[model samples]
Target: MFGRLRAWSRRHSKLVDALVVSPLVLFCLLTLDVYKSGPPFGRYIGIPATLVLSAALITPLLWRRNRPREVFAVVALVCFAQWVADVTLLPADFAVMIAMYGVAARCTARWAVAAGLVAEFGLLLAVLRWDFSQLDAFPSMSVFVIAIWLAGIYANTRRRYVESLVERAERAERERDQQARIAAAAERARIARELHDVVAHNVSVMVVQADGAGFAIDSDPEQARRAVQAISTTGRQALAEMRRLVGVLRQDAAGGEEYAPQPGVAQLGDLVRQVSDSGLPIGFTVSGTPCALPEGEQLAIYRIVQEALTNTLKHGGPGVRAEVDVHYGRGEIVLRVADDGRGASAPWVEGGHGLVGMRERASMYGGTVEAAPRTGGGFQVVARIPVGVAA
Candidate 1:
């Protein structure tokens, strides 16, 4: 019940203050003439009236307690003035309590401490001048006032500390979430690179074999059968690797089925044969001896060629011829795939994932891939991959 009332009072602060203070103001006014009956200035009817009015005005200021400095300054000033005037009929301590709580809750620790000191000093002066020796009084009033002031300072400090802790926790949680998102994005890009290597390598081979099988179906039955067999094997290999790549999405706590090896540079011949069988008339030429490369570098080379061949099969018209040349040198390897298709008459469409993936692959190896229209009426893709040393 008390908690509910306190919440409601907080919500309707202005109304509650008015309701509580208006009656007290009226009571003080009624007793003012009796309390000041001794002297001319005491009986000067406006003095008590002014004090009562000042106390009542403090209620409106208290309504703005959330704005601590403004409300504290106004209330403290009014209470001090009332104390100086010896206005006992109205309890100015009520205003002092509100100002103290406001300072403790909303103001900085330094300000709260300063306000508490001033209030305690003023209270000591008032007590010293007033005749309270006959009254039931505690001998430790100074100690009690000092303790309350210290308690307000401690409470303000603790509140700030708790708020700081909560801010830090929120900041840490946000940073953790941001890092998780970045990791997930990196994982997705890695998967894309892997998928491109697998699909491009196998699909080029299948398309070539399928084309060869179609051409020999009527002229040479035996060769057609061989082409068909190659297609089936290449298709199965592509499908199996595809399934392995896709299986990455499935969660496996025991770390099962994730240790599959990826394709690299050694499989370039298989890729070349697949493109040759597709019937686009591709010539493979290698200038230097084949050497082993890092798995990532090998995958990059494979993807660059795959994207080039896919573009050829899609855009290179009938009677067009394509050539793939690889030059393995002392420090780096240069792979170039060009197609002599119908040139400027068919403008190539721009902005596709194939081109972007090719570029990213080359960039990972600190290399460059350039795809542009050849001056001799063909499209050429020249990619260079640095190897055997840091770039």
Candidate 2:
């Protein structure tokens, strides 16, 4: 309830202030007969003159927050007029100190100090004009004025400090959320590349093996059984790889699926054999001595090769011939896949998701891939992947 009230008060602060101050102003006007002797103006007009001056002094406070400097100047002029005419200090006289506090709290330091100095002068005039017989009242009034000024300066400084702290905290939170979003996007892309490699290659092999099994069921019973068995093996492998990828998506560390090891360059021969079963002949060659590499880099090379082969199978015309070449250098590994077919569209030029995925994977390990049409009549994919000694 208190929190709600504070919010509402902030929204209608000027109205609230007027409600509180209006009564005090009325009281000051009611007690206007406190002083009997003053300049000719006060004596000639009597209570009406005192009431008018008191209202003028207090009414300007309603706009103190919105126009603090103007309010203070106007209040100060009325105060100086009252002092010169020897008007007695009333509760409405407190408006001058209130105006000074507003100026201090809402404006800069130089203005606050100026307002404080002006308020000090008014304090002296108020002390002389007020009907206080005790000498101690003089020192006490001065202390009260100084305390009010100090409070305003402190409030302003503290408000600015808290605002800065809140801004910094909000900025840090935004950056943290942005980083989380970027990491999630990167992980999703990685899983997508893995899923494509697993399903496309394995499903393609299963389809080919099923076709072979159908062809040989009556002509060669033994070849038909072997084809069916190969299909089973490929299906099981695909399921396991899929489980691992799914486990990664769920972030389930306890799941055994995610713990499975990823395949590397050593699996290339098997990959080649499976792809060739679709009636496309492909060649595999290694030009230099091999070296072990990080799991991430190895995965990148494997996926790039897999995507290239899949593209060839999909777009290469009938009776396509493909070749894969790998070279191990002192500090880098290079892979090249070339196909002799009329129908394969160059990925870099044509623009496809598979080629984009390959590039994203290679860039993670600081490598590069180029896919374009071969000069004569085919498609070629070449990648240069830097390496570190296997850990």
Candidate 3:
């Protein structure tokens, strides 16, 4: 509630100005009457002239916030005129100090510094014209002017320093938001690629197995039973994998009963068996020692192999041979999928999402992939994935 009231008062500063300046005006008017019997106000100006000059000096202070330099000028002029007419000083001379503060706080440093010097001059002129006998007052008056001017300068410096800090903080926040957006978009794209691989490969296998079951059901009951079993197994594996991919999209950090682990090179054997059951001759081999890898890299390795084999099943000619070779080296894991099939004119360009996803995945782990038809005939993808050494 106090904060609200403070903000409201700041917004209605004109009202606050009137409240503050009106008292000074009243004081100066009352002092004009006091001067009638007190000191007669410098032998030249009378009550009427002092009242008029005091009004001109104090009234402009009401607009100090809006036009600080103009107010300062008006106050200076009136004070100088009062000194020339030799009028007595009034309490209303406080307006010049207030105006100097406003100018220092609102205007440039050069103007504020220049106004501070000019304000001391106005003080000296008023003191000399009114009471030269009060020469002991000069040092105190000088200190007051210096202290208040320094305070105004300090306030201006502090305000600009705080504003700079605020601007830097806001800029950092915007960059953080932008980075988050980019990460989200990249994750979405990764999920889409994985989804495509899971759905397309598994569905293709199931479709083929179903056809085989249908054809053999009437003639060879045993073969038809095996085919049907293959379809059911393929369907279950696909469903589990799709669930795992979908689970990653869940923002909840809790790993509950439905949580399924992502696939890695260790799962390559199962994938080979599933694809082999659908009538593709697939072989898996490891050339070097395996290392413990990050979950994301493991997923990438698994998906690249999956997508490559799925493409072979779709595009490789009859009795085509496919192989996956994994090599765990000093600083990286080398994964290669090779197929001795009737390769396309540009085997890498035959599919869209498969090659693009492979590159995106490998690049994430600071790796690279080379996908092209071999000179001896067939397609090959070689990915070198960087990683820390296994413990």
Candidate 2 displacement at residue 114 in angstroms = 6.2
Candidate 3 residue spans exceeding 4 A from truth:
38-55, 77-88, 127-137, 161-187, 207-225, 248-256, 346-351, 389-391
Candidate lDDT scores, in order, read 0.72, 0.81, 0.82
Model 1 over residues 114-143: C-alpha lDDT tens digits?
777766766665565463562234336656
Q: Which residue pairs collide in model 3, if any?
A: none
Model 2 CA lDDT for position 190 = 82
- Order the candidate numbers by TM-score, best to worst: 3, 2, 1
Better of 1 and 2 by lDDT: 2
* Best-performing candidate as measured by TM-score: 3
Candidate 3 lDDT tens digits, 106-182: 78999999889999988787677666788889889899998888888887788689779979999999999999999
- TM-score: which is higher, 1 or 2? 2
lDDT of 1 at 386: 81
Distance (Å) between predicted and true CA of 68, model 2? 3.8
RMSD (CA, Å), each prediction: 7.2, 5.3, 3.7
Model 2 off-target regions past 4 Å?
Answer: 1-74, 77-91, 109-151, 207-225, 251-259, 277-280, 287-292, 343-349, 389-391
Q: Return the TM-score for candidate 1, rounded to 2 decimals.
A: 0.67
